[model samples]
Target: MRIVIALGGNAMLQRGQPLEAAIQRENIRKAAEVIARVAKDHEVILTHGNGPQVGLLALQNAAYDKVSPYPLDVLGAETAGMIGYMMEQELYNQMPGAQIATMVTQTLVDNNDPAFQDPTKFVGPVYGKEEAEALAAEKNWSIKADGEYFRRVVPSPLPKSIIEVEMVKKLSEMGALVICSGGGGVPVRKLEDGKLEGVEAVVDKDLTAALLAEQMGADALVIMTDVAAVCVNFGQPDQKKIHKASVQGIGELDFPAGSMGPKIDSCAQFVEKGGRFAAIGSLYDVEKIVTGEAGTWITNEVEGISFYEKKEEAAVA
Candidate 1:
């Protein structure tokens, strides 16, 4: 089986803990154990989230005025290389004889995307409201109050194409565990002269993973997050964990954009585009998720459809 696994940010950080390099490396080592197990049975293409890492890079840049500040797109690419290296090293340590490949992927987005005009995607570090206001004034950044803290917002452009999709596919097929499209790919725009220019935006990793799944003809797009499964009424008294659902059923559930929303949307998009299945589950339970013993499985079938339906009827059912 060919699987595209999108690694969540918390997969590299422990909750309510300081983001120390040593802790991050240990976290990645644990994640690699799960990934190495999956790679043994299936062709795996790995992508990861860089929300915390990129934010730390930006903070480092702010502390040093003598050096040039790296843009988000460049930082995204850097995190891809940085995190990919960590994943590669850990996986190599766990599976000594297996080969691993990491590619610095670039994803194309429209230059004229409306998101460029209205940056709503959050990035960088969280700060107190007073500090946020001061930084907003000093940098002219679009700052928003997120619950008790504030963070910088950036444009989240839709991913049009993965520039290295074919290369990633070929590597995966050649018995190599491939890591690419880190931080939802470095967002870029194609110029009129046929050159690709980096843009100041972040593409959602789950959405990019789904796009890659479609392009690579993947059997499953498994999103491994902090949660065991996607839940309805999340964090509420009436919260319900979803084990399995049709793509249509998922669309009707209420999920927040910054949380479980993009994940459900990505799964639905993959199923609608002809992929067989998509799953959402905890990073620690990946082996079980792949074996169909866990995770919220999203299929193309409707909730009430009968298995005895005619072949032609099932096509449109």
Candidate 2:
């Protein structure tokens, strides 16, 4: 089967972990091990989150008074290149004979997207309430609470189209493990005269991943994040993990906007747009997740849902 795997930021850099090159490389190495296993059986295309990395670049540029900070589009490109290299190298180490390639693809977004007016996507390093407040006031920047810490917020517009999608398709068809669309393909917009220009926005990675999957005619779309499964009543004591759900069923429940919400929404969009099923789960559980052994699988089948607990009981019987 052909699979499009979207790696969440946690797959590369853990929350609260320093963004050191060594730390990121080690994490990618671990992730590559799992991905290599999947590549052995399935044709794969990879994409990943770049919130932490882009934010770090923005912060670093902000500190250097010698030059103006580059726009988010450029930073997105930089992170794509940076992260893609590490992922490609690590994947090569894990699967020596496999052909792995990375591309800094481009995704177009509407210049007039409402996201520009409402910059809700969080980025950069997390800061304490007090520090975040101070920074927001001093820098005149939009800020938002991310878990216990606060970070800068940016517009996360929906991806309209992937510019280099054909190339990606060509590479994957030839059985190459291709990694592209880092930071959602460096957000761009088309001008009136047919020229393309970069935008100051972030394109949600999961949404772009769905677009990639649809374009590639993939059999499965797996979103690998830090969480083991998608849970309902997430923080409550009675919270339950959803093993399998119809796309429509998953849509009926509400999830936090900042975290898992976009992932579920993107997955639903994929199945609705003619892709097979989509799975949301941990990177560590990737092989099982894509195979329907783990994660919250969202499908378009008539049967509503199948709970993992029940499946396990049936096996025991």
Model 1 lDDT per residue over 1-317, tens place: 89999999888875445668888899999999999989888889899988778878877877899978888899998889999999999999999989899999999999999989988676766788899999899978888765577888888989999998989888888888999999899999999999999998999889999999999999999999887776666678775566678888777767777668888999999999999889988887888778755667888654821221234222221
Candidate 1: deviation at residue 82, Å?
0.6
Q: Please give the lDDT score for candidate 1.
A: 0.84
For 219-260, candidate 2 gives per-residue lDDT tens digits of 889999887788877778776778889987887888999899
Q: Over 4 Å off in model 1, which ranges?
A: 145-148, 302-317
Kindly provide the TM-score of model 2 when superposed on the true structure, using C-alpha atoms.
Answer: 0.96
Worst 10 residues of 2 by lDDT: 308-317
Question: What TM-score does each of the candidates earn?
Answer: 0.91, 0.96
- Alpha-carbon RMSD of each model: 5.9, 2.3
lDDT of 2: 0.90
Candidate 2 wrongly placed segments (more than 4 Å): 310-317
Winning model by lDDT: 2
